[model samples]
Target: MHKEQEKVTDKNRFKSCMMKPDEEGNIYCPQGHAFTLEQRKESVKGRYPRTIQFYRNEHCEGCPLRSQCTRSKHGRTLQRTDKLAEMQIEIRENLMTETGQELMKQRSI
Candidate 1:
């Protein structure tokens, strides 16, 4: 039996599994399609109140990677909460500090 070897390099390595939105608030799929904000919902009744934002890519109908990306006919969608976004920003800032860098290096994930 023969098996194919995986090709991984620095150019293709990703630090996080999730694709982050750009500074301008553009969310891109794994295939590089730009997703637009579709809706904003608030969950005031929930135990953890937060604002949810929805993003969708209209051009996914003809995308070759559609089947792999999603099973729904709605193409690809990304949902993020306002609190999560704020936390992400704060985490990024902390990760840039010396203490955060040392913490990252010490962790054994």
Candidate 2:
């Protein structure tokens, strides 16, 4: 019982140490091997379907590190998490809006 408790504690600590905080106070760990935000956006934009599929199928298939990265059988596919993607979309939309353009100008100053 004591050993089991110790193992659990260690696991929690390890997880905590591996986490990185984003600007929005969310935690993520860009470790192991995965696509970057640019890559994910490109995939969504249909700019890199074949490349994405290759990673989703050939590279990630049957790898021992899958558990640490992705739960999908095709390997760890990177889709934008809701908040992250939404933020990007919002920013893009804002840039098109008059108010957003003003804000961008101010940011440049």
Best by lDDT: 1
In candidate 1, what are the lDDT values of residues 38-90, reduced to their tens digit? 99998876577778888888888888767766777877777888687678669
Q: Which residue pairs in candidate 2 have backbone atoms (N, alpha carbon, C) closer than 3 angstroms, thus clashing?
A: none
Model 2 C-alpha lDDT per residue in residues 41-75, reported as the tens digit of each score: 32344543322211222355655644655566644
Candidate 2 Cα lDDT to native: 0.45
**lDDT accuracy of residue 16 in candidate 2:** 30
lDDT of each: 0.69, 0.45
Any runs in candidate 1 off by more than 4 Å, and if so which?
Answer: 1-17, 45-48, 101-109
lDDT of 2 at 3: 31
lDDT of 1: 0.69
